[model samples]
Target: MTRYILTTCLCLFAALAQAQMRWNQAYQQYINQYKDLAIEQMLKYNIPASITLAQGLFESRAGLSVLATKGNNHFGIKCHGWQGRAVYHDDDARNECFRAYRNAYESYEDHSRFLAGGQRYRKLFSLKVTDYKGWAHGLRAAGYATNPQYAKKLIEIIQLYKLHEFDKARKYDKFFARRSKDIAGKGGVLHQVFEFNNNYYVKARRGDTFRTIAAEVGISYRSLAKYNERNRKDILEEGEIIYLKKKRTKAPKSYKGRLHYVKPGESMYSIAQLYGIRLANLYKMNGLSPDYQIRVGDGLRLR
Candidate 1:
């Protein structure tokens, strides 16, 4: 009898653990689906992609909620001052109005811009890409939600899935080009001649901005936006689709190879000598002040 009881208890414990793990996995998959939207927003507005993904996951519950599935509202944003269409739903016993979008990508883009252009989130823009935790907490402090533990919940989601890794800088010219080609093949944008992906997308791991992506893919930024049906003032979302026009890569005058960061104890003179860039050009590239204090991690353009 003792042995049987012990075996049953162990099985129950294992089952509970598995259930908890599955819950976490579901959240991760939700974020993965929309990560690109977060990355695009990060590049455009400096908001960490992790925070964006976490909030979306929390609000949408892995895209299983009716609001997300039917309305493309992954954020549960209230229609406080919105004049557009809306849908009312019951969450805490009372029905509330939620913003509606034409598609999921639109919601993601609007969310990013909402945060970027809003004065309430002004302090969040000053945070570093890696300081996702700070941003998460700051959002709570700024009354993003009524829940007192909102920030903690968001941080937990971000850490559990390693979502903040997207904020790290990376080079993805080829990937962006390929993605652009795929979107163009689908006939999404108005002008295929100059279209590029205009949809919001977050850097899943690390990636490029629309400007950098447009330049590398040989498409104009204006064309990229027009093709994707997005405006210059619109925000980019993670996993969001943008229009891409087919074009040949051009060797522009500003096409420098790749910039290298100056390490500790390294001077501008040594960097210039190593890269074969003139000292004056080096100074100009980095926007050096009269003191010329090149701290670590200062960006330098390489040709």
Candidate 2:
């Protein structure tokens, strides 16, 4: 009897492991297929790509949910005000009205518009594009979900899959490349080198890109990105500052212990650039974890 029980337990464990592996593989495949679309929607609507993808993955069950498979409703957005075709799905209540789409891309686009156009969600747009945590919490605060753990669940999904990497301001993702040609494709290239806190940087001009900047500066692409403390996924944008070398560990010795108040259009990365301080060191000096979203009135240490 003991030997039989052991065999049964082993069989059950193996079956569970195989099911878990299959779910992960399916989720990964879903991400790979829709990541570009998520990034594009982000650029168009100013929503965080990570938040969009995470919401889609969770609501749609990696595109395997009945709503996704049958109605192409990847976001589970209800039809409270939607005028499009509809599908009934069992959610908080049975036969809840959800918007149906012609295709997956249509569903993604509607998801962006649904949030962007909602009066309740207006405040979320004020957050930096990379502030996925803020968006997650704000979505719950704005009644996007009744689930008490909605924000926590979204954060977990983001960290578990490293989905936050998709929240780039801009980059060479195929979507971005096609969107930004050479420079921004709007005007002539013009930049002036400047110095701050003993670090050198240049303002990215119209139509200027990392490739063009690298060629003009006579530095390799990798070296220039490394110098600017940017990862491979970061993209340069017009009129943005591009550091010529790695930033310092802190603000100038003279500016130590100073407090800088956050303002609109400011982010942790932008603040780090403003003071010519290393992003990681700045976070450390402020006792902020990477997931801490800086608010407009928040004060940050400049040491």
Candidate 3:
């Protein structure tokens, strides 16, 4: 009897551990399946990938909910002006109308368009794409959902699974692939491009001029300068960031609550270079004057 009791206890413990592990399995599967679509939407609409994924997870119950499975509505988007196929689901009201899609990808695309085209969600695009928390709060404030805890729940899901990392990773992968193709076609050395805050940049090499790099990369020199917030005539210094695209208004989510202590001889330009951020954006983020000088030991917010 004693042996049987001990065996039963061990089995129960193992079962509980398995159950705990499986608790998030569904969520993980949902992320893996739809992460690419979320990233695509982010690139196209400037929405945070983390916010998109969290909403999908919450509204669709990781695609296991009846609304998702039966209606193909991953975002719980209702039929406001939607003319596509739709289904009725019990939401805030019994048998509420929800927009349906032919497939999950259509649902994802519609969600992006829905947010981008809506006047109420326009302000969300101005926030940093990495700011999932801000987006969550903004969505709640914009009446995306009626739940008072909507923002909290989104933040909880984002933090629990570290979904913000996907935003940068996916962008990097796409940019890297495109850069590789460009290099391959030109039969030249692949210029190393680095990512920060979802922007792609390359270090200025010796004798690399803006016009020359622009010609090599197939972008206009004026556009490159505008993207980097620099004058076209500005001399390109070795190891300085030459952004291949526009910079974000803020830094990555991981940089929140973090400060960069200025070291001796570190200028604002140098600090921005260190983080691969645009100089103007760095200044804007900290509200520093154009002529502001950095002193040793001054704390600068990176996010």
Candidate 4:
């Protein structure tokens, strides 16, 4: 009986060691795969790359957790006014709903925006980019995580992986500084444009006019309106999505057969903008009339 108990203890120890080795290997792979994205987020949002990576490692378990693997929810963000698909999982609460993404890159982008755009995390941006410790603690103080040792764990991960080095890279500083100037011209208007589904788009800010944006992007207002399926005389609203190229007839395969639940103040045009689909196609896909009124909680096909 004594010999059997000793053998069982040895087996358990070996198994635990092997699991640790696998976890370490996974963590290393995760860092290598996403370090560039983390750096990009840091340049764009002023968040520390180390803190982003450490939080990703902890929350997603190096992208191996069910929420990360199945839902592409790397940061474990919950559905707060989310207009897209969602998944439920037990996380601090049972069957909690988390935001789902089209891919891991989308998850990373959303995570950066989630922290940068939130009122609670505004103070974190005041800290130096290299101040990973302060950021880590500030995140905890802002109720980012429920764990008492959340800050300690983030610091430990940062130190162990030397993730802070990414933040101190001079090359990124020069690159982003030049990029920022080009994107945000005189008057602080963000004229930055990005491409998705082979279409170019710029987010509209307060006081942005199609004529102004057309001049900045060197595209005609007529062409811009045609591309976005809007009338040339339409007024641009703050935070509205303006496409510089034609939207796709169908959404990406990942969104096939997906239905969007209309929220308050969301129109068919807004829903098309959200999914990057052509406005006419959106109506056709759902067999709705051009003047169809979408009520709150109504289901609209997105594919």
Query: Where in model 4 is the C-alpha error above 4 Å?
Result: 1-23, 170-303
222-298, model 4: which lDDT tens digit per residue? 89888888788888998888987789987778877778999988988898987789999999989999998889999
How many pairs of residues collide in each model?
A: 30, 2, 0, 0
Position 62, candidate 2: lDDT: 79
lDDT of 4 at 59: 91
State TM-scores per candidate. 0.51, 0.51, 0.50, 0.51
Where model 3 places Cα greater than 4 Å from the true spot, the runs are 1-23, 170-303
| CA lDDT of every candidate | 0.64, 0.78, 0.78, 0.79
Q: Model 4 residue 123 lDDT?
A: 96
Clashes of 1: 30
Candidate 2 regions with alpha-carbon error over 4 angstroms:
1-23, 169-303
| Candidate 1 accuracy as lDDT | 0.64
Q: What's the lDDT for residue 242 in model 1?
A: 45
User: Candidate 1's residue-wise lDDT over 1-303, tens digit each?
Assistant: 999999999999999856654446566555544566577667766778888888888887766677776676878888878888787899754788888776656677778878887898889888888898899888888877888988887887787788888887453234432342233111111112221222232221124346644653456877765544446555564434444532222212454566677799777755653443445666766667636888899767754
Q: Which pairs of residues collide in candidate 2?
A: 183-207, 184-207
Best candidate, lDDT: 4
